[model samples]
Target: MSNRSTRARIGRRVMVHTPVGGSRSVMMGAVAAVTLATLVTGCGGKSQDHPSSSAAGNPAIGKLPQATTFANLKNVAKDSGADAAGNGTVAHPTAAVPVSATPGGPPVATLPDKELGGPTWVPVVETKPGWQRVLLPSRPNGATGWIPAGKMHTAHSPYVVKVDTSARRLSLLKSGQSLGTWTVAVGAPKTPTPAGRTFIMASLAPAKATYSPLILPVGAHSESLDTFGGGPGTVAFHGWPQKSVFGQAVTHGCIRVPADALQQLAKVPLGTPVSISN
Candidate 1:
């Protein structure tokens, strides 16, 4: 674990998770103690530690999708063709392999020889031959891209998390059935929690000075703020010490859960689906 300085930027009004109103900006005052693995991606206002660039000379890829309407941003049902969830390691013939905008499409981002240990990704339901369409842990809430299937590895998770912002509730499910539910704290009106499909990219525990022992960073970001708590506006599922925060709209953009709720959620494997709704 280590410490780092980061910058915060102001953003637009968004009613993502729970509806509460005001100007939502990134919190930049605190010096957060973060795990080394987490620092590679979500920390310091950066999403991925791997450097990316456009690829060239690849006829095996196809066209890229528009950022405005990225497919797979909506609900990811239990059987979304994403049979497994796991971290990606670039095992291709070369470093800086192209990540397509769509399955078998042109490159949108490139992967490095090694990832700085980033988030988990789910392959798209219907993938092209030899290519896997995987969700990315980047901006715009729900982003997906394509990577070579042979270049990655994954594991399955039966657990899933569904959050209802309007009701201020968080539910844990195993194989589509509810295991438990808890009241939670969502984003305030100005910096409302974003709604969409995302996944647990990483499981982290801060060394000190935090309310929660575990932090589940999702593949989503705060639509209202550019950064918060030294992160690149990455929305996370975490716990708070105060019971008063639960069932309230009072966070920058993170889901504030209870201690007991976090304990149960801990059992969920990394890369599990996390759906947030209005």
Candidate 2:
């Protein structure tokens, strides 16, 4: 994990991801508009703090299978109800693994060994004999990349989350049963949040964000904003202290939640499904 500045450019504030896991809100709309576009979205300090490892290039492929839509990086066989199918098992990575552009293509980015700390890689979807396609934690949302299967270890999870932009709410479920629900802030009409089947790529605690203690960077991005907070407009599940923002269209593209709601969401494993809809 390199200590690179992961800041983003909001309307006028320069939301910086500090090397110490702290967030610095500097006003740089005029000073560094170009620089802000280069910052990553959430958990600024190191790329390792989040599961969406940095890769240079467009990761958009096409529509994937229904089940393969989200990142299966932490779903184990037993948890995925895979005792029967045995085909859609998610494999966790034992060591740092290199992501490929194609089934057996060149290296795009190297995934750190740690899975945002606890829940690591559970790569399913075998593409070829030696290669497997896993969901990437990148912008333009729902991106997938290939990696060597032999380099990964496997797992599963039974939890899932559903976010409804129309209703401005989020629901958590386990084995299809509701655990909890909460109001949330979505993107403004001009900067709509990218929807579809995504997953929790990482759980991060910003060193200095006044809103909440944690942030969950999802495998989605902003459809309108190209580069936000210096990153690739990557959408995330984060907290906002402002109560008024709840149940409203106020964010650049990220989903904003109350602090209490964010605590519960942090418990969910990385790579768990995060289905967002309009």
Candidate 3:
């Protein structure tokens, strides 16, 4: 995430199943140039006290923990049941999880129909028992499954996110679609926040991190973002300096909110759909 988020990398998780239905394994993959790629895009920031100069102006700043690097550790159900293609090693760290194509590959029964765009490298969301699962490439395709959940990660998670840098606030959206909004800190005058329609690709619990909207990637730890850049520094939502300046037009490009706001955003799921406009 630190440097690869801006590259031509694709990420997805290996799938596993369980009694609870279906789930995905921990995410793994290499997204070179993923998180900070759009840092140069011309997205704007928000502040009731001061607005951005870009098209996507004045996003609200919300509450977020004072973090420079954070992760949302997602547990997989364990892979006691993955198709057993052989021993597969996880890939380099990035926002997306990576599963090396097995040597012999999975069992024929476990493979998805190639025509249906079945089973390929995908970012794992949750894992289950006796099955490996992944996001279906297409609609009606839903999710692909394989492997058992016992050896992968864990099962299920409880957390959601909502970001409003223009208002300088983030909302914690629960499973019920409700949320708790708070303030946050974003990019600074040099490392301003980026703007675009983005979502949480991966997450990990926070450590001694200081950046808001912390993400969970592989090695260096970077969040997966699929936002369309508007211009140089055009993307929205990114980490910034945690300072006394919350409501002010201060950043190189991206919006700068507070710490609590980024923490709330860290909970959102990958591809969670965002619509940022002035």
Per-residue lDDT of 91 in model 2: 60
In candidate 2, position 199 carries an lDDT of 72
lDDT, model 2, position 252: 71
Number of backbone collisions per candidate, in order? 8, 25, 140
Ordering by lDDT: 2, 1, 3
Candidate 2 matches the true fold with a TM-score of 0.66
Q: How many Å off is the CA of 141 in candidate 3?
A: 24
Please say which candidate is ahead in lDDT: 2 or 3.
2
RMSD of each: 8.5, 9.1, 19.0
Better-scoring candidate (lDDT), 1 or 3: 1
TM-score of each: 0.67, 0.66, 0.31
lDDT of 2: 0.59
Question: Which residue pairs collide, candidate 1?
Answer: 16-193, 17-193, 20-189, 21-189, 61-104, 62-104, 62-105, 62-106
Candidate 2 Cα errors over 4 Å, as ranges: 1-31, 34-91, 101-109, 114-131
Tens-digit lDDT string for candidate 1 (139-252):
655566667777655555777788999999999988667899999989887778988777766676665524567777776777865544334566788877668889998887
Name model 3 segments beyond 4 Å from true: 1-160, 185-196, 204-241, 252-257, 262-271
